[model samples]
Target: MGNEANARQLDHHPMHGVLKMSEFINALQVGEHHQQQTIQAYTEYRFAYRICASQLRPVALLQITYVLEAISSATRPTIILQNRPDVASLFTIDPQTGVVRTVESNLEPGSTHELLVIASDQGLPQPLESTAFLSVTVEKSNELRPQFDIVWLTDNGTPQIYENLTIGYVLARISVRDAKYDSELSMSGCESICMKQTDSSNVYLLIVCGVFDRELKNSYNLLFLLSSDDKVILEHPVHLEILDVNDNPPRFEHSLIRVTFNRSADQFDVPRIVATDADHEGNARIRYSILDTNVFSIEPDTGILRLQKEFDCSAGEVRFRVVAEDGGKPPLMSIVDVIADVIESNAWPPVFTKPLYEVSVKEDAEPGTCLLKYLVSAGLHWINLYPFDPYLDN
Candidate 1:
């Protein structure tokens, strides 16, 4: 009994390496011309499998022998995978061959899976078995596509400024999540905006890198790229919307305007000057006026010039300045020259300033040689004088 006390528990065997086994015992007697003693024999097992490559992509399969170590039993053993019925649903095992395989392709990246593997032998009365724990991990694939956030803003955000945004404006901040690789990102096919990353993070900043102009271009589209060895690993598309700013002043089509005036009418079209503004909304609204309104005025909405007072027939030419301004925060303005051309009418006869005049000419007083002439004309009439031998008036 002393020597038998050191014996191990009895083990059973199951045919085909089934995971359940029956118990059995073998006993040897120790004697010195004395009674017989029973010695018990036990079975032991060793599994040599430690999975080295279980990181697999989606829809991948792994062999069972690669992870299931061999089982040993004194009476020929059988091996099987043992797990809860529900847990068993995750995989299938060949009870005869001791092979295991996955049942689904829904593995997640960077996640681990575990299974219970058991081995048994065919023995009488009951069965003896040994168990092992196995683990596997799924990895991400290199063929996965990149993704980005979506935006649908027809109108620009608050402070929708299309021109001249401050140099350090914070346009956007984007955060990324990827477990396959720690790749750096770059921007391509962009003219106005740029991107930069902070130290030790996947977050980046979309910044205003260059100047903006609403007239030339108000928006941009950028391609965000991730790569290694100059080869593209992933790409995402982003769009930007620019709002119009009130920076450019209104301008007239012509810098100089000419107006013809008649004493009868005090109205004139300074060619109805045409002006344009580049800013958006109210900033692009333009107003017009004659700088000096004493003699001339212009319609604020329409650039029509008008003479405020009546002019006489002898009115002379005059020079006036016309101004155009836009309604911006700081307001912008321009000016042009408006010339008033006066055309006199022939409605009255000429009047002499002095009625009487004395002639201070050299009077020879000779017959037919005396001369006294005045530059005077009859009303709508003309005559040619005749001279005789002694002169008509001698």
Candidate 2:
């Protein structure tokens, strides 16, 4: 095929499509190269006529098979793909052509395979070989699913998150596996929470996106999904409890209270003071106390007020402040003003100054005879009254 006689005969009598064939040969002689090639994981690739071919010639009419070989030698070059021993079994190349394919099914995405393609020609003295560097990047496949590990927020074996946390506060950490470079993570069922993935290591952070109130809602159910190419790959469900915070103070039913106390009685019982707190658990427990203990006392648990000390019947009024405090950690409190009107009543009966009235004429005194005088007192002053001997001890 390299003889001068055959070359002249082909030039005089050109075959059909010979001009296109000449252009292909010229392009091969010059050179063409692909900087890099990318393919999806577990997919096949073919190099075909892109092998080390320098020229081609049609030998005969009966056999139209073209003999393609390197211009440097008559024998065809052997193509070999070189990879690291660790990943050598993952890829293979045909010795005849440069067709490369993955033999292993489990090829990770975002992995770059650096391979050395050697084309060696069968020369007489020393074989000529040329090495071409090939970079093949495995792209992510939609069929692959994602895996993840989550660090849950919990208290006493119960999953919970503290309320009143600031926005962007991290609730949990998640480490992701088998995820692509373009994979996305999202959360549903909770508008107050969101997920964010880190730039490195594919780690995700679950954070607070809105406000949380334990009194309004105590628990939440959350769903998280991992997607790639707009397709869902994994789903996770989380059950969480919202921890309580002392945000509500005790509220009094009445800001100002009025009561009437009768000094004629030994003690006065006040009406129950009502107060409420809108917090949960221990934060809602309320205790009552009075600022002035000289005349007023209150129950620590029941908020029952009582007049414990004696006061002048002529005293117009008594004013005091009552405090209602909750049992929270830092404790919240509220106050109410109380006014008591003291009055003396005439409904009480007379009392004797001495238990035994032993006047001289008491035993033989008649029913109308005055045995004793000035025996009882009323209010803050003493009053004189006629008394009769009802009984005498022998």
For candidate 2, give the lDDT of residue 378: 56
Return the lDDT, model 2, position 281: 71
Query: Residue-wise lDDT of candidate 2 within 1-394, one digit each (tens)?
Result: 2211011001111212111111101011211321112111121211111111112211111101112332432444576778799878766765642445556656565566666665554544444454444454544433334555678654553347888888988888888777787887777777898878777657888888899999888766565666788976655555567888999999987889887776555544446677999898799999998986478788889987676878886767889998999999999999999887877675645676777666677457556665557657554557777654555322
lDDT of 1: 0.51
Write one digit per residue (lDDT tens) for candidate 1, span 1-394. Answer: 1211111111110011112222323222222321222223333222111122232211111111211122222234355766666556555654533435455555455555566655554443345455445454444433334333322322344223456776666677666555235576777655666677767467777677778887786544455666656675555443345676778899877888777765434334244666888777789898987774467677899887666776654657778888889988888999988777766433344443359756543456555553444443333333333324444355
Superposed on all Cα atoms, the candidates' RMSDs to the truth, in angstroms, are 38.2, 34.2
| Candidate number with greatest lDDT | 2
lDDT value, residue 179 of candidate 2:
77
Q: What lDDT does candidate 1 reach at residue 381?
A: 34
lDDT of each: 0.51, 0.59
Residue 340's C-alpha lDDT in candidate 1?
A: 77
Q: Against the true structure, candidate 2 has what lDDT?
A: 0.59
